[model samples]
Structures are given as structure tokens and as C-alpha cells.
Target: MAALWPLWGLSPGGSFWQRFAFWADALDPLLLLAPADEIRRSRLLLQNSGKTLSEPIQDDQMRKAFLLSLSSVHPDTDKIIPVLFRPPAFLPICLPLVIVSSLHLQAKATFFSQFVFHSYTTGFALINGNSTTKAEEYSVQEKQIFYSLGAISYAACIGAFPLVFMNRYTMKSPLMELIVRKLLPAPLLGLMSAFTVAVVRSPEFEHGIEVVDRNGKVVGVSQKAGEKAVRETALSRGVLFGTTFFLPNVLTYFVQRAKLAKTPRNLAVVRMLFTTLVLGGMLPASLSMFPQRGEIKRADLETEILSSTEEPVLFYNRGI
Candidate 1:
């Protein structure tokens, strides 16, 4: 896995495409079902191999285990994130919710779907973020409930805005109506997704997460790094949800125009498939947009962090 990073251009400050390739391999859906014992063995093999350099592990089993552990385990916590919130399960769980959220259903159904989607995404964002090394400082359960409610409330109200608008006003032009119905949801959903992530992960920004040197030694807690981490996650999420929501609707529109699926049932099936494919592809791409192990220059960090470490470049876990 270490050797594969360079091959995939996954340097400390690697480009987006490099990050994307790493995610594509890491987020394989089949890995989600790996047995608990197998995962334990994989982690053990990785720990015992002691291969610290960029050279590839000689054993194929070790390499596979490395990838599995990388996707499933949180580096800071060293615990398996909840299965539903893990990256491997992201596409499978989110695709259907996103498809339903984008659909022009009754007002009640639309709000319900939007609420569920936001709640799930919020949980994912919170879990995948840089969790505090100190557990005693914050109330995890209380914060989770509070943030979840806030995100769902925002999503429900904003998500319903377009539908409410359409119902209240009669558009004279079919083109205008089409724009509102088809084109508006993508950006709106994208914005809401980003907002939910920022809100759910706000504690990290407020309290700060740990920053470490290149050698993985803790220097100090840095709020600046926390802010940057949240910002990057939010941007990637916007891209993920924005493109996922937008492309399927546009493609479905063109398909309908071309008479690709004559019947409503056929069209629904086609749209569902399209949504699945788009989300599967976008999820990895968006995840790769930034390095999971992010870097910060010594000067960019807080003054206390600057005093604590002389290393020119420091690293932190930028949660997936």
C-alpha cells in the first residue's frame, strides 16, 4: 500500500486525481462484508510486517489487508467506524437516499426523504472527522443529537423551499418550470449537504483537533488545522452531492427527450441505475479531492504549534 501511493500520485500534497485513484481502490464495496476475524488478521499482518518505507509489502495478503484496514479503521481512534458511515458503504446507502431526495414527490414524502438523507450524511460527517483525543472534554451523545436535529431542520426547510415556490407560483413558460424543477435541486442539495457537514463537525473547529509531526509525534492541538479540515471536507461533499444530483437529472432529461425509455416504469428504473452509477463514481472522486493525511506548513499553524515543533511540515488526519 505504501508503494502504491507513489504509483497513484498520493504524495503528502498529492493532486486531486491521485487522491481519487487511492479512494477508488480503497472504497470497494465488497470490502464492507469482510469477516471480523479476517479484518483482525489483516491489521495484525500490517502491524507485524514492520515495513515503514515506501517499498511494497511482498505478500499479496498483506497488501489487501492494508487497504481494508485503511478504509475501515480510524487512524486517531484505531476503531472501526460504524459500517453505515464507512466509505465503503457510502455509495450503497447514499445513492438511494439521494435519488429519492431528487425525485419530485409529494411534499410530505419530499420532506421525509430530505430529512433522512441529511441525518445520515450528518452522522457520517461527524464520525469521519478528526475526533478529539480527549474524550472527557465534550458530550458526544448530546452533541450528536443536537447537530443531527439542526442539520435535518435546515435540510427540510431549505429542501422544501423549491417545492413550495413551485406550488405557489404558476410559471407561464414550460422552460422556466423545467429549470426550477430539474436544475434547482442539484445546487440546493449540494449546498445543504455542505452546510450539514460544517454544522455537524463544528465542534472540531471550535475545540481544535490534534496535530502531529511527520514522524507522528503529537505537537499540540490546533484550531487552524481543524478549520482547514472541515473546509476541505465540506468542499468535497459539495462536489460529491452537487455532481451526483445534477448529472442524473440532466441525463434523464436527455433520455426522455430522445425517447430512450417510453414507459414511466422503465424511465424510473433507468434513473435509479443512473443515480447509482453517478454516486458510485463521484463518491471516490470527491473523497480523493484532498489527502486523508493532510499537511500544514509550520508557519500556517497556531503560534503554540509553531513553538512546539520545528518540522517545516506537519501532518493531521483529514477525516474522510
Candidate 2:
């Protein structure tokens, strides 16, 4: 699986479309249902083929195994990431949560919906981070719980805040209410999504993650690389949720103006369908925005790491 990373958009300098194509295939939900024995066999096939060349031989079986491994396993630790948290499960799980959260529901329902969405995303961010070598002191389950709860609370509050405010202080203008209730949530969700990633992965910023040379040798831990990884992931997440939440509403507004869906039920169905399409497209595009194995100039790293390696560039996993 590690050997196949570069071919799967972990390498540097692929066009966004190229990366998107890769993710579209790799994130297939069917791969999530593959049994343990199937995954193990796929890994074995790739490992055996990877020994002979830099790239695995292109074949149907090889492609299936590669996608299965990429979806199910973590690149940094070689451990199976939890089923719900894996990239393959991301769309199926998050799409509905996102749709439900974006709905014009009652305040309490909105809060609950946002809470569940953030909670799941928090777990996804935590499990997908490139923190395989996180400092031993930070390994306690309590710290993880604390971070998770803090992120979920923060996001849930932010997500439902607009609706809560409008409900308390009735707006005189329909335009103002529309702006407050509809337009505001997308950017807020986007911002809070990014925030959740930062809060959830705070330990990585504190303890640092392992950086590797061109040959994939771990030189040493660097706080700089960890910050870069988390920052990139956060930015990608912001683009994802922000666009996912914002675009559908804009389209819905235009649709309403044109009387595209006259009935409330029809409008609701159209909106949900739009949200689904936007999320499906944006998830891959956002994730493909940066190379999973990100590069940083050697000069920008710590003095000790610079002295230890002659390579001018270092790479680290920028988790999805």
C-alpha cells in the first residue's frame, strides 16, 4: 500500500483533474464492504507486485486491490482506519448529515443535526491525521475525548447560531432573514469545519509528526511539518463544506425565483438533490487540492533535520 501511494496522488505535481479521477475511483463505497480476507489478499498482491518496480502493473485486479487498500488502510501507520471514518465511507455518511443540517429545521433539531455532523467529522479528522508517531504522553483516550467534545460543541454552536439568533430576534425584512438563515450558514459551516480539524488535530501541532526524505526515510520529527499538514487539511476541508453548504442554497434561490419547484415538497426534494450532487463533486475536488504526501523545502524545517539530510525537499502525509 505504501509503495502505491505515489501512483494514487500522494506524489507531487498532478493536475486537479488527475487527482480527482484518482479519488473518484479510490473512494468507491463498495470497497468499504470488502471482507478482511479480501483486503489482506489485495495488500499481498500489491506488495508482491510492488517489489519489482516503482509502479504496480496496471491490471483490473491490481487496480481493485489498490483502491481497496487505499480506501481501507492508513498510509502513515498501515493500520485499518475505522470503517465510518475511511474516505470511502465519507460521502455516504456525511452527505445525509450535511443535507439534514442544512435544512430549515427547528432550532433544537438543527442543533442536534449539527452536533452529529461535527461529531462524525471530528472522528474522521482524528483517525485520518498523519500522527502515527504522536508522542506517547498524548496517547491517553481522555485527551482524545476532550478534543473531540470541544470540536463538536464549537461546530454545533456555530452551525446553529444563525438560526437561533433569527428565532430570538425576529427580522423585519424577508431579505435580511434569508441572508441570515440561508447565506450565513455555508460560510460558517466552512469556517467551523476548518476549525474542527485544527482543534481535533491540536496534538499533532504540539508534538510534531515524522518527516521523510525523498527515499522515504524518517529523518526526525518536526513541528513545522505537522503544522503544514494540519493547515493544508483544514484548508481543503473549508473549501469542501463551505462550497457544499453554499452552492446548493444559491441554486435553490434561483430555482425558487424561476418557480422551478412550486410546491414545498418539490422544492425540498430538489434542494436535497442539489446538495447531494455538490457534495459528491466537491468532496473529491477538495481532497485533491493538495498532494496527500505533501512537500516542504528542507530550509524551512528545523536546523537539526536540515543538518541530518542532504535532500532539499521533505514529504509528509497531508491527511484527507
- Which candidate achieves the best TM-score against the true structure? 2
Say which candidate scores most in lDDT: 2
lDDT of 2: 0.81
Candidate 2 local lDDT, 190-309, one digit each (tens): 998999998888777677888876555677888888899999999999999999999999898899999989999999999999999999999989989987768899999999999999
Per-residue lDDT of 89 in model 1: 86
Q: What are the TM-scores, per candidate, against the unseen true structure? A: 0.89, 0.92
List, residue by residue over 1-320, the lDDT tens digit for candidate 1. Answer: 22222211122235778667667878898889887777777767666665542344456676677778877776667677778888888888888889888787866788899999988888888788877644454585578569879887888888887676777785437787677678888898899999998888877777788877644567888888888999999999999999988998889889999999999999988888888889888888888888777778889988878888789987677787
lDDT of each: 0.77, 0.81
Candidate 1 regions off by >4 Å? 1-15, 53-59, 133-135, 169-176
